[model samples]
Target: MAWRPTLIFTIFSTILTQSLAKGKSDSPICGILRTLPNATSNYSEKYCILFYKTISHLAGDEDSTLYLPVSDALEWDVCDETEPPPASLDIENRYIFVSSENNCSALERASRIQSLGGAGTLIVKEKLHAPKQNNTDYNFTLAFIQNSSYVKIMDGGENVTVGLYSPEDSLLPLSLVIIWFLAVFSVGVGAFWSGKVRHKLYLSEQCGHVGEDNPMTCREPALPHEETSMNLSAKSIIGFVVLMCTMLLSLYFFYHILVFVIIGMFCIASGSAVFCCLQPLISRIPCATCRTPYFNIYVVRGTLEVRQILLLIFSFGLSIVWVVMRKEPWAWILQDILGIAFSINVLRVLRLPSLKICTILLCGLVIYDIFFVFITPFITSDGKSIMVEVAKGGTSQEQLPMVLKVPNFAFLEISNICHITDNYNLLGFGDILIPGLLVSFVHSFDLQIGTPCHLYYLVNVIGYGTGLVVTFIALWLLNGAQPALLYLVPFTLIPTYIVAAIRGEVVAMWHGDSDKFESGESDMDSPEEGVPNGSAQIVT
Candidate 1:
C-alpha cells in the first residue's frame, strides 16, 4: 500500500507539469539547456549554439552553448510564408529564423524575420558574393554563414549539431599595408622606368633620326600645325563612341563567356607586352649586309626571330591555361607579370605633350568618371547608375576580367587595404593607362632637352603613386562605389604642375618647344614616315 501511494503521486506530478508547460505563453520553443555538460558529453546529441555579437558583450564562457526553440526543420521562406505563424507553432519567445532570400539584403531579411517574432536571425551567403547592387548601400547587422555545405545541411532539416563561432575580427594588418604600398609604388616606378628604357632602344634603332632634337618631329611636315577646335571635337566624339562600344562589349562578354573573354584579352595584351619587352634585345640584332639594327618586327616582314615567336606562343599558352585554371596561383602570377608588362608597354607607346594638356585631359576624364558614377542614375530611365551597375553586374562569381587584380598573399590572415574583400587590389586599365601616358611623355621630355633637374618625371611618378593611395582612402571612407579618376586627376595634375612650375619649366613645356626643333620650310627635311613634325601637330 505504501509503494502504490508513491507511484500515484509520481504520475500525478508528471501530468501536472505537462499541462502547465502547454498552458504557458512564454515557453522556449527550441528549449533551453541551462547547465551545459562537457563537450564530449554533448557529442551524442544534435544541437546548435546561438551566436552572440561581440567579445565585450560576453557575460561568461558558460553562455557560449545557449540554444533556442528554432528547429532545423522549420526553414521559412518569408516571401512564401504570407500567413502568420499558427497558434499551435508557439515559436514566439526564444526562437530565431533563417533566411537566404536573393530579393533583399541580409539586413532587410533580418528585419522581416524580426517582424515575424524571431528573436534572432541568420543569413546564408556564398563566398566572395556580397549583397546585391541595390543592397550595397546598407550594412547588414545579422550573422552570415559562408559555408555553403553547412547552410545546406541546416536548411535540409537533418538531425545534425551545428556550432556557431564568432567571426574572427581584425584590423587592417601591417602585412597587407606593406604589400599594397609596395605593389602600387613598384608598378608605377617600374612601368615608367621600363618605358624610358624601351623608348631609348626604339629611338636608337631608327635610321636618319639619330640625335634628332625630337624623334616625334621627324614624321611630320616642315610647317607647324595645330589641332583645330572642330578636329578636337570630332576626336572627342569618336573616342567616346569607341569607348562606349568597348564598355558595352566588355559588359556583354563578361556575362556570357567570361573565361573565354578573359583568356583572349590576357593573351593579346600579354603577347604584345612580351614582344615590346623584348624590344631591347631585338634592337641588338644585326642585318647581314646593311649591318643595321631593326626597331620593329612589324615593319620588317619575316624578321621575327624564332625565340621571339616561341616566347609569344608560350605567353599566350600560359595566359590561356591561367584563365582555364580560374586564376590559381600559377595563373595569378602570370596575370600580374603580364599586367605589369602590358602597363609598361602602354606607357611607352602613349604620350601627352605638356602639363597644360595633361591637366586638361585629366580634368575632363574626372568629370566623365564622376558623371557616369554619380549623376547617371538620376538621368537614366531605370534610375540606375551605369558605372555602379557595371561594377556590380556580371560579378556574381568574382571574376572581373576588365580589371587586373594583384593578390596580397604575404599574410594569409590579413586583408589587403585596397580591397573590400580579403583578397587583392582591383585596378582598372584606365587607371594606369591615362596617367601613365603623361608620365611617359614627361620622361621623353627629359630625354629630349636633357633637363638637369630630372624632377619632372620623378615628381609626376610620385604624384601618380600618391593619387593611387588617395583612391584607396576614398573607397574606404565612402564605403560605396567611387569614381577613382575623380581623385586621381586632381592628385596627379596638381603635384605635376606644382613641380613643373617650381622648376620654371612651365612655359617651355606648355609651348612644347622643348620637344621640337625649328626646321627649314623646305619639304626635304620633312618627316619620312607619318611621325609628326612637332609634338602637338594635328593627327590629320
Candidate 2:
C-alpha cells in the first residue's frame, strides 16, 4: 500500500500525457493531424509516456507505434533529411540489404514523394511474428526521426517507411503498473487475511446442537437416510470415472516410470480412503461366532491421519530433488511448484454435484494447466537477446515468443520478465483436465465416513466454489481483465469452508459414543458393554 518508485513513474507519465480525443482518437494516425487540446498533457496521459526503461515493462503490444526521436529538435515530418543513416557505416557495407529500399526497386520508386512537395517520415509498422522467423527490428529503439513541419503535405504521395520497428516495442506496455499493484496486492493480502480469520474460527469452535457424549439425542440427523447404508452414493460412481481418467493421464508420461509413480500415488490415496469408508459398515454387521482369525477385519485409519497427510506432502519433495539433481534451471523447478499450486488452488474451490463431480473437475483443471505449460503459445529464443537486430531486412529469422528452450525443461515466458512462475507451463485444455480431476478427489472426499466433520459436506462445497471463483477473478485481473468483479459478486460457495470449519470444533461430539443424554438411557452401557463403550461408528 505504500507508494513506490513505479507509482512515481506513473504520476510523472501522467503529467506528460496529452490527447486530442476529437482527432486521432477517432481517425487514428493515418489521417491528418487534426486540431487538438494541449498536445503535451493530453497526449502524454492518453498514451503512456515514460522515461524509465526496464525489461519488466518493455515487451511491446501488437499495435503500438514507438516514436523515438534521435534528437529532440529533429523534424519528425521528413526522415529523408532528419533520420540518420545506420550508426555504423560498416552496418550498411557488411549488410547489403540494410535499407528497406535496398532490395525493392519498386519501393524506392515509391519513395519519390519529394516530386509532389510532400515529405515523408519513416514509420515502422510492427506485426506479430515467431521469434526466429521474420522479426527484423531488434534495437532498443527505432533508428528514426520525426518531422512536424512537412506532415500536412505528406498525405497525398506514396512513402517509404525507413524506420526499424521491433515488435518488442508495443503499445502502452505495462501502462497501469502502479494501479495493478495497488489493486491486486491489496485484494490478495486482504483475502489471505480473511482466510486466516475464518481458519481461526474453525479451529476454536464449541459444540452447539450436538452433545459431546451423544449426537442421537440432539434431534434426528439432518440426512439420517444417507446414514442408513453405503447405498452406492453418487460420489462412488464419480470415483470410478475419475479413476479411469487417472489411468489415461498415466499414458501422458514421457517415461513409463513416471506413469507407475503417479498411478501408485493415486491408488494409495484411493485405497486408504476406501478402506476407511467401509470400516463402519463392516463393524456393524453380525458374523457367526467363528474363531477364524481371518474374519477379524480391523480397520486402520491412522496411516491416513493428518500428520500422515503432511508426510505424504513431504514425499513430493523427492520429485523436486530429482529435478534439481538433474541440473534443470530454477525456472523449470519453479514451474512444477506453480503448476501444482495453480491447479490445487483452482480445484480446492470449484463446485460439483457429487464427490465424483469434484474428481472430474479437478482432473480437468490439472490436465489443462500442465498441457498448456508444455505447449504454451509464445515465441522462443535461441540464446540471443532480441535487442540488437537492426541490420534491416537480412537479419535472422525470429522464433515464437514464450516458448524458449531450457537445459531440459522450458522457461515458459509469459512475458519478457514475468513468466509462468518457477514450474508451470501454458494454459491448455488437457492440462486443465488432469489436474482438475486430482483436485476433485480432494474436494469430493466424504469426511463423514468416520470424522466428526460431516458439516464439511456443505462447508467444503461452498469453500470450494468460493475459492474457485476468487482464483478465476484473480487470474482475470492479473491478465488485464477488469478487476471489479471480485467486489461486485460475493461467492456463496465460500460459506462451505466456514461451515466445515465450525464443524471441526464439534468434532468431540461426533466422535464419542452414545451416552445417557444421547440414547435417552438413564444410564448408558458403561465401560462394560459388548462393544467398546465410547468409540463412534460410521453407520453409512
Leading candidate by TM-score: 1
Q: Model 1 compared with the native: what TM-score?
A: 0.59
Q: How well is each residue in 298-375 modelled by candidate 1, as lDDT tens digits?
A: 312223444555555665665566566753544556665666665555454444445555666666566666766778
Residue-wise lDDT of candidate 2 within 254-284, one digit each (tens)?
Answer: 2234433433332232233333333334455
Global lDDT of each model? Answer: 0.46, 0.26
Which candidate's lDDT is highest?
1
RMSD of each: 19.7, 21.4
TM-score per prediction, in order, is 0.59, 0.23
Q: Provide the global lDDT of candidate 2 against the true structure.
A: 0.26
Task: Give candidate 2 misplaced runs (Cα > 4 Å).
Answer: 1-139, 143-153, 156-498, 501-540
lDDT of 2 at 292: 16
Local error of candidate 2 at residue 249 (angstroms): 13
